[model samples]
Target: MGAVNLYVTEQYLLLKTVDTLQQKYGFRTLFISDARDEFLLEKYDRRINHVICIRRKTFDWSNQLKQDIDSYLRKFYQQPQLFRGKETRFSIVYVSNLKPVDSWEHLSKTMRLKGRKNATVTTYFVDEYEGLEELGKLTNTIDKNDNWKMEALPPISEQERQMVYLEQKIVAIHQHNQRKFEEIFQFGKTKWTFVLIIINLIVFFLMETQGSSTNSLHLIDWGAKYNYAISEGEIWRFLTSMFLHIGIFHLMMNMIALYFLGEITEKIYGSKRFLFIYFLAGFTGGIASYATNDAVAAGASGAIFGLFGALLFFGLHYKELFFQTMGRSLLIIIGINIVFGLAVPQIDNGAHIGGLIGGFIASQIIHLPKKTEGTKQVVAIIGLITLMSAMFLYGSQQTSASENPQTMAAIAQEYVESERYAELIDWSTDRIDQGIEHEFVYFYRAVAYLETDRLDAAEDDLFRSIEINEDFAEAHYNLSVISERENEIGMALEHVRKAIELQPANEQFKQYEKELSQKSTSG
Candidate 1:
C-alpha cells in the first residue's frame, strides 16, 4: 500500500484546482505527470512527484506505456518492513480521456475484482476544451467516496489576472521610488555631497560679489596668465576658476544641471559611485583647463559634461535597460549640449572634453562591481588609475610651478622671442625635477639648459623628454642643439633632420637645422 496519488495533465486550470484541493484537505498526496509535460505541470504545482515520460511511439501500444507507468509507481511506492509493521495502500485519481459516469464505475469495479481491495481508482472523462466542467465532475467523484471529503477551490477569473499584473506593477514602482530617494538623500550620511554643494555655492557667491572681476577673467586673459601661472604653481587657479561663475544666471543654470544629472546618475549607480564620478570628472576638467586654456576658467560645467558622459556610457553599456527605452531622447539631449559647448566661445571646450573622458572612464570603474575578478576588469581599473595619477601629478606640478615669478617671467620671455633654447634652460634647472617627465616641460627645460651653457643637463632633459613622449618634435630639435653644443657633428645633424622629419613646416625646427648644419661644418 502507498499514499494517495493524484495524476494531472498539463492543463493549467485543473492543476490549480488540484493544488487548492491538496492545500485545503491536508492530503499527503503524490503527483505524477508525463516527462514531456513535466515543466508545464511543475509551473502550476511544484510538489508533483513520480513523473513518467511517455515515449512518442508511432502506434498506440499499451505495453510500453504500462511498463513506464508501472516502473514509476513501483519506484515511488516500494517500502521495506520497519518497526511499525504498517502496510500502505495505493489509490490513484486520474484525470484523462472522459466517458460516461457509468463507464468509469465499470472500470473501478473491474479493478476491485482484480484483488486490490485497498486500492481505490477514480477517472474523469473530460473534453480538452471543457476543462472547467471536467474539474467540477472530478470534484463530485471525490465527494462520493466515504473516505474522501471535497474542498472548495478558488475560482479563477479575468479580474484575478488583471489584479496580479497590477500588483506587480505597483511593486516595481515602489522599488524605483525607493531607489530614487536613496540617491537624492545620499549626502545626509556621507556629507560629501553637502560639502561639495556648500563649496560650490560659496565660490559662486564670491564671484557674484566681486563686481568686474568676472569681466577681467576672459579665456584669453586667463590663458596668458595660465601659461605663466602653471610654471609658478598656481594650479589651484585652474580648478578654482571652474567653480566661479559670472552671474546668478550662470550659477543657477550650472547648479540645476548638476542637481538633475547627479540625481539621475546616482539613482542608476548608488551614491558612493555617483560621488566618485562627480569628483573624478571635475578633476579631469581641471586638468584639461590647465593643459589647453590660459584663461581663468571657473564653473561646474566640467562636472556637468562628465555627468553627460557617464549617462552616455551607462546607456550604451546597459543598452537593454537604459538605452532601449529612452536612448534616443538621451542622445538628443547630449547632442544639444555638445553643440552648445562648441558654440559658446567663453565655454572651456578643453575642460568639457576632458571631463567627458574622465566621466566615461569613471563610469566604467563605477559600473563594474559585477566584474569582481576578471582580466578585463583588472585592466580597466589599472588603466583608469594610471590616467588619473598622471593627470594629478601633471596638474599639481604645473599649478605649483606657475606661481614662481622668476619661472613665469622666463617662460613668457622665451615664448615671445621663439627662443626654444632659452625656455628649456629656464625650465630645466627650475621646474624639471624628480617625478616630472612631461615632454613639454622637459623640452623647454632642455632648451633653457642648452642656451645657458649647460650641455650635459640639456642632453639629459632632452632624452628624458623624448622618453616621455617619443613624438615630440621640439625635444628632438633640442636634442640636435645639445649634440651641436657638445661638438657631436653627426649626431647633431641626425637629430635636427629627425625633427624636420617629424614636423616639416615648422620654421623654428628648420632654422635649428640650418644652424646645426653650420655648426657641424664649422666643427
Candidate 2:
C-alpha cells in the first residue's frame, strides 16, 4: 500500500498509524510524501533531489512506476512455483495521491494478473478536486470501497490549510536566506554579544544549583521577577531578574537572541551606552511587569526587546545601512516573535513593551562622543529623568493597590506570595472602602477576581480601573485581553491600540494590536 504526494508537516504520527493498520490487516505499507515531509522520506530516497526529480517528471515518472509494478506482478503470477518458496501467499498493492487528470486511466477493470489467484490492486484517488464542479465532469467518480476497490483518507479541511500556511511562513524566516552563524557573528562587532551570552549562561548554572530554574521558588530566589517579592522591597530584582530564566530552553533562546542582537547594538551605540540602555530597559520592564501582572515572570526577553528598539532607532538615523545589512532579517524575526507572543499564553508582555520603549527613548537621547557631546549628555539626562518620573508615578499608584499603609502593603504582598488571593482581595476592598479609587487598586482586585474565575467581576473591576486612570497602559492591555476572551474582537483591538499609544515602545501591545486588528478584519 502507498500514499503518494501527501502534504503534511510531521509524518511520524501518520506513519505510525499506517504501520499499526498494516500489521493488523497483514499488508506492507509505503508512503510517498511531498517536500515538506522530506525528513521522513530521507532513508527511502537515500539520494537528495532523486525522488523529487522523479516526482517532477510527473507523467513519465508515474508511468515508469506503473510499468515496474506491472512487470513485478506479471513475473510473480507467471512463475508461482518460484514465488511459492516465499512466506506470503496473498499480496495487495495500494496506490494513492494521484493528481486529478481526466486522461489517466490510473486503474481499469481489464488490468489483471493471469494465473495469480491472490493479487489485489487498489487506487486511492484523493478528493482534491472539490469546490470546482467542472473537475467533477472530468472525474469518473471512483466510488470509495466499491466492489472491493478503493479506500482514501479524507482531504484536509480549510482550517488545517491556513494553519499549515502560517507555520510554513514562520519556518521560512532566515537571516538573509539562512546565513551561517559565523557570518552573523563576524559581520561587524560581537564582543559584547558574546559577553552577555556568557553572563546569562553563568546565571543559569547557579540557578540550577539552587534548584531547577523552572521551579517558581528557585526562580524567585535567583532574582527571577517575582512580583510580590519586589513589591515587598526586593528592588534589586529589577536589575538581577533580567539575568535569570525559568528553564533551560528559555535561557538558551534568550542567550542566542542576545548573541544575535547585542553585537550590532553595542557597535552602533558604543559599549557604554549599550550597557546603559540594556539596564534601563531591564529596569523599566521590571516596573511594567509589577504594574501589570501579579504572577511570577522572568527572562531576558524584555532586554532583548530593548535591543530591537535600539535597532529601530539606529535604522531611523542610518536607513541605508539598516536596510542593507540585516534589516529584513530583523523585521522577520521581530514579527514572528511578536506574533508568537500574541498567539500564545503565559508571556510577560508588559516587560517586553517596557524594555522596548526604554531602549527606543535611550537611543534617541544617548549619542556618540562628538563635538556636541555636552548637549547630547544634557538631553539624555533629561529624557532619562522624565521616563523615570513616569515610572515612579505608576509605582506610586501601585502602592494604593497594596492598601496605602506601608505595613498593610507589606502584609498584602505577603498574602500574594503565599497564594492567599482572597486575603489580597479583602485588602484591596478595604482600601476601596476607605475611598481609594486608584486604577492600581482596581486593577489588583481585577487580577484576584480573574484568578478566581469571576469573569464578570473582573471585567467590572478592569473597567472601573480604566475609568480612574484613562492613561493606564496595563488596564487597556488587560481589558483588550478580556475582550478577546469574550469574542469582542473589535473592542479588543481598540483597547490594545490604546495600550500601545500609552506605552508606544511596548512590543507586546503592538503584537496584540497586530493580531487583533487582523482577526477583527478577517472576522
Candidate 3:
C-alpha cells in the first residue's frame, strides 16, 4: 500500500473501532476532538467505571506520548471531579496503531504503580488494524479471534462521506447524553422548597411569639408531639408537630438542612412529589416518636431526613450518577448523623429513622419524574398504610398515665390550660384509682376541686401535693386559698408565707401574701 493509503487505513480503523465500541459494547461518547482524530468514550455499570481514549494519529515513546498521557489524565480527572471529588476508582484504556517501542518496556509496571494511587492504565497497539479482541477484554464480551472485519479503503470521495457520517454519529450521542443528565438532575424549579422554608419560618416565629417555645406547656399548646394528646383524638398533632420547632437552635438547624436537601429533591422529583415525600415522612417520624418516646417533641428534622430518603431513592435508579455526584459523601453524612443521634440523648433519632424509611417508601410510591412503575408504587402505598396503622395502634396501647410521668404531667397541663375542671377531676380520679401518684396529677386535681367549690377535697389534694414535693410553691398558694375561704386567718398567713418564700419572684404569690398579712393583722 502507498503511504497515503496506509494513513487512510489507520483513520478508517480508528473510526471503525469507535463505532463498534459504541454500537456494540454500549460505551457513550464523553468528549471528541474538533480535528476528528481523538475522542473519549465511557461505559459504567454497577461493577465498574471505564473510560477509553482513542486517536487516529501515532506518537513515538520519546516524543508526545508523555504529554498526551498527562493530557488524558487531566481530562479524565475533570469528568469525575465535576460531579464528585476524585475519590472513585479509575480504569483508562489508551488505544492507537503505534507498536511498542524498546524504551517503553517499563510502561505496564509504571501503570501498575499508579494503580496504588487508585487508578489503572493500559495501552493497546492495533498493529493488525482490524482486530478489537484486546478492547473486548475491558467489557469481557468479545472473545479472542472474534474480530470485527472491515472492507478495504474506498475512493477518496466515499471515505470523506464515511468520515462525515461518523462525525454526526458522535455529535448525536454526546448531545443525547447531555439531555439525559439534565432531565434526571434538573427536572423543575425549586418552588416547593422555598415555600416549605417560608412556612417553617412563619410557624417558628408564631411559636416564639405565643409564649416561649421552650416551655412544655407552650409546646403542647403549639401542637408538639405529645403522645397523650395524640391518644386523646388529636391525630392532627402528627402533622402540626412537624411545623412546630422546640427552640430557635432547633429551628435553625432543621431549616438549614431543609433548604439544602429540599432544593435538590424538589428539582429531581418535582414540587408535588417532593411535597408528598416530605409530609408523609414527617407524619411517619411523628408517629414513630409517639410510639417510642413519651416526651414533648417538635422539629423539621424528620421531614428533612425524608428528603435524604428521596435522594436515596434517586440513587437506586441512577447508581452511576449518584456515586459520581454525591453518593459516597451522602452516605457518609447520613452515617455521621445517625452516630451522632445515638450518642446524644436529646436528639430525636426515632423520628429521623422513621422519616428516612417513610421518605424512601413515599418516593417508591411516586416514582421518579417522567417515569412510572405501577406495581412497585402500589406495593409501597399498601406497605406504608399498614406500617403507619400498626405504629399508631401500638402507640395508643402503650399510653398509661401510671407508667409515664411525662404523659401524666402533659395531660394535667393540657386540661388545666383549657379549664376543663370537671373532666380533669374525673381523669385524675381514675388515674389515682389506678395508683398513679404523680405530683402534677395531684396538683391539677386540687386545682379542679378548688374551681368547683369542693374545698375539703381541694385541701386534701393540696396536702398530698405538698407532701410529694415540699417546695411545691403553687400547691402552697392554693392551700392558702382554701384556708382563707375557711376564715382561718393565721393558717392562710402561714401558707402564703411559705409560697412566697419558695417562689420570691412570683407576683401572684406576693400579692396574695399582702392580702393574707392584712387579714392576719385585722383578726
Candidate 4:
C-alpha cells in the first residue's frame, strides 16, 4: 500500500504525531513549518523542511489546502490491491479541523456511504478544544474502509528530553567563546605601537656602534655635507643621508621624535598607509636637499614633517575624532621644526624647507584609503617624474662638459697642489689633444704646459676660460698676469680691462685696471 500522511498546525504537535505514528504503524514521517515554528521543529527532527511563513492576511487558502490534500491522497490512495487489501484499495484520509473545501462536512458524510466502493477518500475534522473527542470522530469515519486499524502509542522518555537540552547548552557556550577571542585580538592589533618598537631598536643599535666619549656626531655637521652635496647636484644622497647621524645625541633625538610622531601617525592611518607616507617623506627630503645650496641636511625630521602634513590632511578629511585629538599638537610640532630648520646656521635650511614641502606634497599624494581616492597620488607621480627629469638633465650637462679645456685646467691645479706636476703635464697634454672647449681648463693646462715650457698650451686654456665666461674674473686676471710676464703689455692691457669690467670691486682687478690705465697714459 501507499505511505500514510499527516499534517498539523504546530511543530510540537507534528513531532508528537511522528513519534506516535512510528511506534504504532512503523512509518517514518517528515515535519515542515515556517520560521516561527521551524526552529522547534529543527531541534526535534534535525531534518525538518522549512517553508515561508504565511500571515492570515496574505495566506492563499485555496492553493495551500488543495496542495496539502492532494499530496496526502497521492501518497496514501494511489496503489493496487496487492499492497493494500482489495477492500482498502484507493482509500485516503485527513485528520484536521481545517476544512480543505467548502461543505467538507457534507462531502465527508456523503463519501462514507455512497462514493465508489473502495476508491473513496475520507476527511475527519478534529475539534481544537476537544482533542480525544476529535480523534474518536476520525477513527469512526475511517472504519468504513475494511483494512482500517487503530492503536494507542507510548509517550516520549525523560532521558531523551534531558540529552537534547544539554546539546543546546554546549552549542551556546562555543559561540560565546569564539566572540570573546575575536574581541581580544582586535583590541591588541595596532600598527603604531609595533612600528615604534622597531624604530627604537634600530636607533639603539646605530647609537651603540657610532657614539664616542668626547667627539660626538652633531646634526650641524651632517647637515652641512648633506646640504652641500645636494646643492652641488648629488640628489640621490638625500634619502640615504637622512638616516645618517654625526653623533649619539643626533641619533637619539631624531629617534625619539620619530617614535612619538610615527606612532601617532601610524595609529591614525593604518600600518600599510603609514609606511607609504613615511617613505614618500624621505624621498621628498632628498628633493629638498638637491634644490638648496648652502644648507647641509640630515635626519628623519623631513619624514616627521610629513607626519604633520598627514595630520593636517587627515584632520580636515575626517573631522569627527582624529581632528580634535591630533590637530593642535601636530600644528605646534610643525611650527617648532620649521623654526629650528630655518634659524640654525650651517644647517641646510633649504633641505629642511624642501623636505617640509616634499612631505606636504607626499602627504597629499599618499592615498590613505580614507574616503574617496584623493588627487594626491596623481600629483605625486607627476612631481616625481618632473624632479627625476630635472636631475637627469643636470647630470647629462655636467658629464658632457667634463672634457672642456677649462675643466682640464681645474683638474691640473689639484695635481699641482698635490705635487704631481709631471703626471699633471702628461694628463694635460693628453686632454689638450681631445679638443675641450672650457677656457679655465685650457688655461690651467696651458699653465702646466708652460711650466714644462709648453707656453702655447697655457695661452690656449686661458683664452678658452675667457671665451666660456666673459665675466670670468679669475681667468682674465690670470691671462693678464701671464701676458705681463711675457712682456706683452698690449695683450696684458687688453685682458685687464675685461677682468676689471667683470669685477670692478675686486682688489686684484682694481690694481690691474689702475696699472693698465697708467701704462696706456704713459705710452
Which stretches of candidate 4 lie above 4 Å from their native place? 1-236, 294-296, 320-323, 374-376, 387-523
Q: How far does residue 108 in candidate 1 sit from its true spot (Å)?
A: 54
Deviation of model 4 at 438, angstroms:
16
Higher-lDDT candidate of 1 and 4: 1
Q: Write the per-residue lDDT of candidate 3 for residues 283-304, one digit (tens) a residue.
A: 9988888777777889888889
The CA lDDT of each predicted structure is: 0.54, 0.59, 0.78, 0.50
Among these predictions, the greatest lDDT belongs to 3
Q: Which run of 10 residues does model 1 get worst, by summed lDDT?
A: 79-88
Error of 1 at 329 (Å): 2.9
C-alpha TM-scores of all predictions? 0.40, 0.42, 0.72, 0.37
Best by TM-score: 3
Ranking by lDDT: 3, 2, 1, 4
Cα lDDT of model 1 by residue, 1-523, tens digit: 1111112222323343344344443232222334322211111112211111112111134443344445534543442110011222222333343333332233322132123333322323332345346445444433443233223323334334533554344335445644644444342243444456677788656554643334532321333225445455665554556566656777778877777777667756667777788877877777776665645556777777888888887667654334323455666777787688789877778788888888887787666333343566567678877876676566556665444333334443445355556534544555555334356666666556666777787788789878887887877877876776667879988887888898999998888778777876776
Give the per-residue lDDT of model 2 (tens digit) for 1-523. Answer: 2233343311322332233233322222222335432111101111111000011112235565566456545644553222221121222222223433444445422233454443333222222233123112212222122222122333445435544544344234222323433343234454667877888889889878866776665566577665545655788888888888888888888888887688778866667878877888878777777776556678888888988888987677655445545666777787787778767667877788778877777776675323145676577678767876677557646754553333343444555566778977986897788676667777877877777878788889999988887898988898888889899998888889889989999999998898888888888
lDDT of 1 at 485: 62
lDDT of 4: 0.50
- State which candidate, 2 or 4, has the greater lDDT: 2
Candidate 3 stretches greater than 4 Å from native: 1-13, 33-38, 55-64, 71-105, 108-118, 123-159, 401-403, 406-435, 443-523
RMSD of each: 19.5, 25.1, 6.8, 25.2
